[model samples]
Target: MKLTKEIQDSIPFQYANDVRSGKITTGKYIKLAVDRFFQWIDSAEKDGYHIDHNSGMHVIEFFEFFLKHTKGPLANEPVILSPYQQFTFYNIFAWKDENGNRRINHVYEKVARKNGKTAGLAGLGLYCQSFDDEEGAEIYAAATKEMQAKVCWEQAHDFVFKGIGLRKIGFKNTQREIRFEHRERNGNVRKGNFRFLGGDSKTQDGLNPSLAIIDEYHAHKDDGVKEVLESAMGARQNPITYVITTAGFNTTSVCKAAEDVYKDILDGHKIDNHTFIMIHDLDEGDDWEDPANWVKANPNLNVSVSMKYLKREYTKAINQPSKIPNFKTKHLNMWVDAAETRIEDHIWMKSDKKIKLANFIKNGCAGALDMSSTTDLSSLGLVSNPDENGIIDILPLLFCPSDTIDKRSKEDKVPYRFWKDLKLKDYIDFEGTDFSEDNFWEKLPVLIATHGNQIDYATIEDYLQKLEAIFLPKWWEYDRWSATQLVQNMTEKEIEMHPFSQTISHFSEPTKQFEKHAYAAEFRHGGHPILRWMMSGVQAYEDPNENIRYVKNRSTKRIDGIIMTIMALAGTITPEEDNNESKYNHEEFTL
Candidate 1:
């Protein structure tokens, strides 16, 4: 029943231990990732899973034995993986299912540039192709551009041509592919192929890949290549879809979408056992100038990317100023403008406790609306009165035109159609059919889909009336710019409509309060998927007077739901307190 020292000092757990002991510096996501590893190990057997240490180290030993540094200061030297890389390799190949197949088949790795990502993965591509006990394995280096795909494929090709182990074993190659053939003990000939598959390639038809190395995945503008390769892997017995990249500029890209899902998995909002996620980035509010903090982002600080090289880039960014975004994104592994500070995401996730809405319905609540545009998303945010525990429950009801759900979902890169169809029974706990018909609020879907190509105000008014009959909010607040008709209609219906001006003076205190509630874990939102997405994309703008308000710049994504939450929380504050400065310590809002 006891484990060996080698198992205790396994690469992943060793790195996790180092992180806990302060020997390693990283962000909260990495902390969560290591915790996930430990939790999985603790329950592996009960969950019909087990760890195979030899199988994990087999991949590592393969790299050290056959792969060589194709290009670098250590060119032609044997490929020796660093601690972080050892951790990555072991995780990829260690765990086994009940059937002894690879436990994790998909890997999402986000790290800073110049971290030897490509070389390590190129070696992995070779390992999966030549060994791994898979016959006729089809390995691919995939990317949006042909040249980009060739980068990894070329490194892998060079490793085979330049290295002694693979060459002596015999292989054949073309400009874009490498082939290996062997005869099994049963006298059956097995063949393997490794090549580049680009989105711009002439034909992606009729292909099967056992290992897909998606390099610099953030550069991909869409999911064409990723989806194609993923779908093609269905026939393989044990397939791996490996996406490796640094932080990027495009927030709505497929890579960012994958990152969002990965974050949810780490936050315990979603369960995905077959996917492995490791994100290395600087923690929020870290002083980038501090050399001590650099290791958090650059795991291979002195190994592949030198401290001197980072110093030079940092100096240039300081002098040029405009280059700061690139420096922060590529070197610090920060998503730069994509995730500009509004709130700490980890703290926001921590506050995502379940809410039994029925518990607070009769207590009354405050409502706010952000009717963005006739064609885009409109949000209705409701905040419940604080209970004796002082915890506020927030619920967001998003609305979009049914006809435009598909189009808008594609454009915004968020699932509008799925959210639109979400029934109240899925998220809300209406007490014993009192607020439901057939145990479901059929007409009161959480994400309402108004008919036709533009949001139907009449349908919104109707839903408001239904909500009004049940919750009886104290006041309904609206951003005055485009809600004239809806405001008039609701006011005539005897539903109190108060105009909440969208200004720093009106929003700053509430925004600060929301941040306070998030940090204190005093709010619950049922882990609403769409609301969490909006919160993650919010960017804050600060004035000279230290007033902060969420802003959606050209580069930024939508924050309509977030704005609605702030406005709704604003209505809950006493009018006298709304005009006064926030009582919370200013330093606490630094995040």
Candidate 2:
């Protein structure tokens, strides 16, 4: 397609073609030239003057005005323009079909920061509001916040009020909408009004937008907001949806979604039905210090941005390496790691410890149980016996309730089912063989009587009482072994003496509180490797202060494992006590 005189004059067309043809080696230079040209167009248009070839605003204004009026009758499709619109229109809107059907296109762009994104988009807004073919066209420039929305609105407002020829076109900016009235051959008519709508589903709903621009689209907290805006576009035939933003924090975010769509277009994952342009710094490695990487990532250098500003930021970032990622990605318009490490290696290493599974099993075990109410996992902590030397062993068990079962029932896994699946029932040996599955209640008294002297069972109730009486105040003072042992004792079957209700009500608060304190304190202390591991594996949703009220956040496998170990220690304690008692009885008789 032959370039129009106006297009040839616009710097974007020249730089874009140069970049496409490999003549322009620097992406930043091309971006700057393009952005500068667009800014000039915006300035001229705002002043109510026509941008001719010599003026450099001609091509920019022409592309913007073309998009506004290109949709003949099907103007409501969410239309997005790409590669700053002018470069993309050659393939999409510049030519007429043999059948005379003008190709309608949707455009999307992913560009880095500080390269005239707002300015270029504002120019488009001006053209759409002033010269678009649709009369009374409802145009919207949206962002996550009202302030962001206003930024676009203000730009458009300035262009309409200040652009050279736009004033004569009767462009008027009201409090909320920009309106223009003009005379056609048929009759006097009014057209080109744009409204600013902040990014929210409820705010954009029910509006028939002829054109919509989603600025910084990735920063939106929820995808639903974007979806709502897209849904609103269905009312406009051949409507344009312009998604322009930089990379987001993670691949899961909105920016990544748009990036993926762009990639799919490039990779033939989808038909190239829409116009997509992705101009990003191609810096590949972790090395941000390399000037080569900087050049690759920032394509707006020396034009819109001064080299001095880049050097200053680079020096500042280098002085504090911690700020490199943010500076490189946000300011330099590069893709870098946005998710900072939540756990430092040194902190984790300082708290790490190793123990053999055999040794863990040999120790008298106590359990800490974290039950769940959702499909989230239940956790168990099995604390090892404290030897005469005051050492504690700990093991963790996790049980994740099945999502399907929980979802279908709207209930957590049945306790009996969990016990059966984990073989916990087998590990928990009842003293009597006469125990009945259905009538376990009838045999419970006998089992309790037989094991009464052998085991110490504490229900959740016993655990809480012990916490309030002995654990809370001394929690931090306890060594790793003592803390683990304490938690184990609380989980024992012998402590299970209950009107089960008594245990449930009393254990609820304090137990939760202890868990919370213990979890955070252990996290802070950076010791108690086993406790740290258990805590790391714990997915509890207890308040920061309470552990007993904690609900499991993930699968219960780890905590449940820990709880079983604790239970083992509690149940086995009786044997040791009984042996000691027998020895004393024999000595007394002999005496």
Candidate 3:
């Protein structure tokens, strides 16, 4: 634990100790940051922070004041950095704090395309806009389009007009911004700016930035502009959020749910020391025509990349299989399994038709529960809306309490008493509940009761009186956890429930609205076998941005009746259908 002559002349800390001692050919989170950076440099006094070699040699002397080739054969020279960009500027300016602050405040550097990562995170957003001592430092580069947020804001405006004290920079470019003013050590003077935002921008809340270069975050399709730039970074301090990217085929992005939480914190199964992942792909089933697995995802191979332009695009993607998913998702960063599924069990067994619930008497349904965890198994799901042959039906019931339906039908071997009806302390089939243990049913005062693996409000007011005697439900969305007698009987029968919360900001738009009407076949269901084995045990997991959730993976399986049929098809579908109030007439009935 003695290393410091600039981290022993770092080359990204000797290529993260030669990719953690195998002599390099990377991946596996740079060998899990070389065993979590020498157990964080041998427990910097039991992990509270230390190493600040003058904020890591003032970001390696501000990248030696620029110039090492803005273009061809070394255009001005000085630059010199490439041991993984001096190991990401010595692990992001040598992790400080103890009044020095900056303890890696979020950075997700996925690599690949000419791996300099948009000119080194646009030169760390121009050193957090004029030297990291943030004071009015709102710096951005974020993108979704404004031509991908002006590719790292025109390379941090050509490295602040080609270097040298940022070319005597006084700031102020205005016309889309680039400002500067800084001056601090207490004499005070703030103004830092440097902008460019756009996940279809409009309002990203009152931002406080202090450095936010998200550039190409997998062309974001929701994480609501990284949740308003992380809730406008609570008026800044240690605010970073960097996210630089490359591998993107949109596997329900938020950059593929933060690349599955940076591959579960590089497989030690998650710890997150303020998120600093460096995922340079290519490992799983390597040999992408092996040039040592293409330097295990080009960490600036031959600096600014060129093994003769990746062997001429790996010989035109080994003979054009449609250019092998854009050269394995842009110069091999990877995730190209772009099949982002929702249903395909033969179109979900061709929406297994069999409809019944006395065929919708009062009309228009919606009710999607989803409880589980008292011995697991709770779902009620309903959804009817699109009928004039537009199909759209779906039922699913499930429950399971008659003493854990014979131990979850021999531990989920399936047949749970044929979608068992309802019976908590024992049995009361949706209606007549004398609950008998003697007098007012052992004071259980039964109404939707079950208090162990939760679900009470006993068969929801007898399934809302047999679903309003079939069809009559404009709402009832449930999912967050229930049983306070179903929110006190849906607030005493004025029933219009709602609750939803299953995060990824409210189940990522009803999971892409139940994957777009179940891939447009519209949706109808009944052959039930525990809702077709919980829709072939769905796996969805995205959430670093455009939410997808359906949790419990690695095959523990039980998609709570497909999450109460996508929370009753996200309040019974609506992409604009007021063809005079989206249907249901029963002679203008008054119930």
Q: Give the number of the best model, judged by TM-score.
A: 1
Query: What's the TM-score of every candidate structure?
Result: 0.58, 0.49, 0.35
Candidate 1 TM-score, C-alpha based: 0.58
Provide the global lDDT of candidate 3 against the true structure. 0.65
Candidates in descending TM-score order: 1, 2, 3
Alpha-carbon RMSD to native, per candidate: 19.2, 17.6, 20.5
Better of 1 and 3 by lDDT: 1
Lowest lDDT 10-residue stretch of candidate 3:
582-591
Q: Each model's C-alpha lDDT?
A: 0.78, 0.46, 0.65
* Residue 325's lDDT in candidate 2: 52
Error of 2 at 188 (Å): 2.9
* Candidate 1 residue spans exceeding 4 A from truth: 10-12, 338-591
Q: Which segments of model 2 are wrong by more than 4 Å? A: 1-13, 26-59, 62-104, 161-165, 235-237, 283-287, 332-339, 342-591
Top model number, lDDT: 1
lDDT of 1 by residue, 442-483 (tens): 655757888899988887777677667777877778877879
lDDT of 2 by residue, 122-179 (tens): 7666665655556667778877766567777787776665454566767788988888
